[model samples]
Target: MNMNKREKIYLIAIIVLLGLLLAKSFYLDEYKPVTEDEILFREYVEKVIDDKFHGFFSRSKLIGYRIVSIKKVEDEGVSVIEVKSENEGEYKNAEIDGKYVAKIRKYLFHVLPYGEDKILSRK
Candidate 1:
C-alpha cells in the first residue's frame, strides 16, 4: 500500500484512539456499580432454607436461624452471594450426654444473583 505522511499520522492516531477506547471500556466495566438488594437477599436465603429443611426440622428449631453475614463475590463475570447463618437448636436424633442440647449450627449458602431462585450451594 502507498501511504503519505498525513495518512501515516492519521492511521497512528486512529490506532491510539482505539487503544484508549478499549482500555477505557475495560476500566469502566471493572468498576461498574453493582446493585445489592438487602431485602431480596434475605428473602431468598430464607426461602431456600425453608424449602430444604421443610419437614426435617420443627418450626421452633428453625425460628432461631439468623443470617450472620452476606457477601458479594465476583467470579468469572458472575455475581455470587455468600450467606452465613447461625442457629441455636437441637435437631432430631442429635443428643449429647443422653439429652438434647442446644448448640450453635452454622449454615453457609452460595447463591446466584442473576436469579434469586438459583442456589449454588448450601452447607
Candidate 2:
C-alpha cells in the first residue's frame, strides 16, 4: 500500500468527509417538517369534522381522516392519536374524557399533551 501523494490527499479528504456526513444524516432524517403538534393536530381534526357534521357534507369531509396510529405517553403527559374516518361514520371505540377539545361553532380547538377528548378510540 503505497499511499504517498500526501497519503493520497489525506485519504481522499477522509472519504469525502465520510460521504458528507452520511448525506447530512439522511437529509435531516428524511426531510423532517410538520410539527407544531402536527399542525395543531391537523387543524384540530378539521374542527372535528366541522363540529361533527354541521356543514352537512358538500365537500371537505375531514379529507378522509386516517392516522392509523400515533403514540406518546411521555409519563402520562399524553398523546395517543389513532384516527380513522370512513367518511365520518366513526366506527366506535370512543373515549374523550379530558383535553383534546375541538369545536367549530365558537371556534375552540385544543391540542396539547393529549389524553382523550375524543381522538379516535377503538383499539
Candidate 3:
C-alpha cells in the first residue's frame, strides 16, 4: 500500500524519535536506586581499597576516595570495580601527591587488586 506524503513524513519522524530514545538509553546514565546489598557491598569494597591504597603509599594520607563504577564479570560471581582517589604524602625528600585510579576484582567476600594504580595527577 502506498502511504500519502504526510503519512510518510510522520512515519519517518516517529522512527527518528524512536531511534533517539534508544540511543539516549545507551549513552546516558540512568538513575538507579541504591539497594541494601549494594550499599553493604560498596562499604566493604571501599574499606578493602582504602587499606590497599594506604599500604601502597605508606606515608600517604587519602584526601578523597570513591568507587567510580562496578561491573559484573560475565556469568561469574565476581565484580570489577573502578576506584578514584586523591592522596598526599612525603617519601624520602620528595613530596608525593596525586589523584589516582584503580580497578579491583571482588569475589564472594574477598577482594583482590586487579592492576597498577594510574596516577591522574602529580607534582
For TM-score, the strongest prediction is: 1
Give Cα distance to truth, residue 57, candidate 2, Å: 6.3
- The residue ranges of model 1 lying beyond 4 angstroms of the native Cα positions read 1-35, 60-63, 75-123
lDDT against true structure, model 1: 0.38
Stretches of model 3 off by over 4 angstroms after superposition: 1-33, 56-59, 74-123
Residues 1-123 of candidate 1 have per-residue lDDT tens digits of 999999999999999987775564334322222234343444445555665655533354532333433444322333233333344332221111111111122222211111112333222
Summarize candidate 3's per-residue lDDT along 10-123 as a digit string, tens digits: 999999987775554334322222644344344445655556656433334313233544432233233333333334332122112222222343221112222333222111
What TM-score would you give candidate 1 relative to the actual structure?
Answer: 0.30
Residue-wise C-alpha lDDT for candidate 2, range 1-123, written one tens digit per residue: 677799899999999987775564334322222445444444446555556646533243422222322332232233444344456745322223223322122211211111223443112
* Model 3 vs. true fold: TM: 0.29
Of the two candidates 2 and 3, the one with more favorable TM-score, higher being better, is 3
lDDT of 3: 0.40
- Evaluated at residue 82, the lDDT of candidate 2 is 35
> How high is the CA lDDT of each candidate model?
0.38, 0.39, 0.40
Q: Candidate 1 at residue 109, lDDT?
A: 24
- Give the clashing pairs for model 3: none
